[model samples]
Target: MTVNPGHTFARIAIVTVSDRASGGQYEDLSGPAVEQWLRRAVAQPCEFVRRIVPDGVESVRNALLQLCDKDDIDLVLTTGGTGPAPRDLTVEATHQVLTKELPGFGELMRRVSLEQVPTAILSRQTAGVRGRSLIINLPGKPASIGICLAAVFPAVPYCLELIGARKMAEALPDSGA
Candidate 1:
């Protein structure tokens, strides 16, 4: 894939999986939260492709695959469906379409979350690479999303670069004559 520097904007897909949210019983905070965080964190311009789906493996899997394969989304972040609940199938869905798993992301996210809440262990947040897209599953709670993103975002840019995205130069001091 050719990296379009002019298209410096990252195409981000935010998916929130919750039956209630999808049904409009409550606002989809998770998706918006991710978009807010991305807008703040990334210097590159970004466009959000958002979705709110029910907690079903097939739905999650299809959404992920479509975003990566068809939409050509650079990053797909999903919230909800990563818990121990029977409907929590995000991790499995993510694994289904991934060519390779990035285990460190889940480990690091859990570790960061564990500092804030003991029940963080119950979270099964995970990440993987499909084609050139990187998919990360996060907790449904807005706060946990922020914490996890902070813990993992440092590596995201580098990972994107390694995946053949645009190069980000390390800041250097210039001596002006």
Candidate 2:
């Protein structure tokens, strides 16, 4: 698939996989938190496609398919559903859509989160590539979202470049893409 990253901005899809958030019981702080962090981490502008879905393999999976397929988002970042809970199904949904798994993103986020909380192991945050879209599952906590994203954020642009999601020189300020 040819991923069309616009010259003006990179496209991103933020999905919050939580029954509570999707049910309107609570606001989706995690999804917004991810968007906030990305705005600061990425130099280029971004076109964000956001979604709040209930915790279910099908719900999350369908959201992923819609974002990665029709939207052509360069990145799909999900928060929630990565825990050990029976309802946590983000990783499973992510796996359902991924063509290639990138173990290092999950490994590094877990390692980084482990430093702050011992229960980080219970978190199953993971990442992979589907076609040209990179999908990463992250923790639901607002505090941990930034920590986990920060741990893996530096490599995100490079990862996107390597996967042909974005052109190499668009990341380089002097390259004149």
Candidate of highest TM-score: 2
Which 10 consecutive positions of candidate 1 have the poorest summed lDDT?
A: 168-177
Clashing pairs in 1: none
Q: Please list the residue runs of candidate 2 whose C-alpha ends up more than 4 Å from where it truly belongs after superposition.
A: 5-8, 167-177
Please give the distance, in angstroms, between residue 86's alpha carbon in candidate 1 and its true position after superposition: 0.7
The true-versus-predicted C-alpha distance at residue 108 of model 1, in Å, is: 0.4
RMSD (Cα, Å) for all candidates, in order, is 4.8, 4.0
Native-to-model Cα distance after best TM-score fit, residue 116 in candidate 1, in Å:
0.3
How does each model score on lDDT?
0.84, 0.85
On the 0 to 100 scale, the lDDT of residue 37 in model 2 is: 75
Candidate 2 per-residue lDDT over residues 87-146, each given as its tens digit: 998899899999999999999999999999999999898899988889999899999998
Number of the top-ranking candidate, with lDDT as the measure: 2
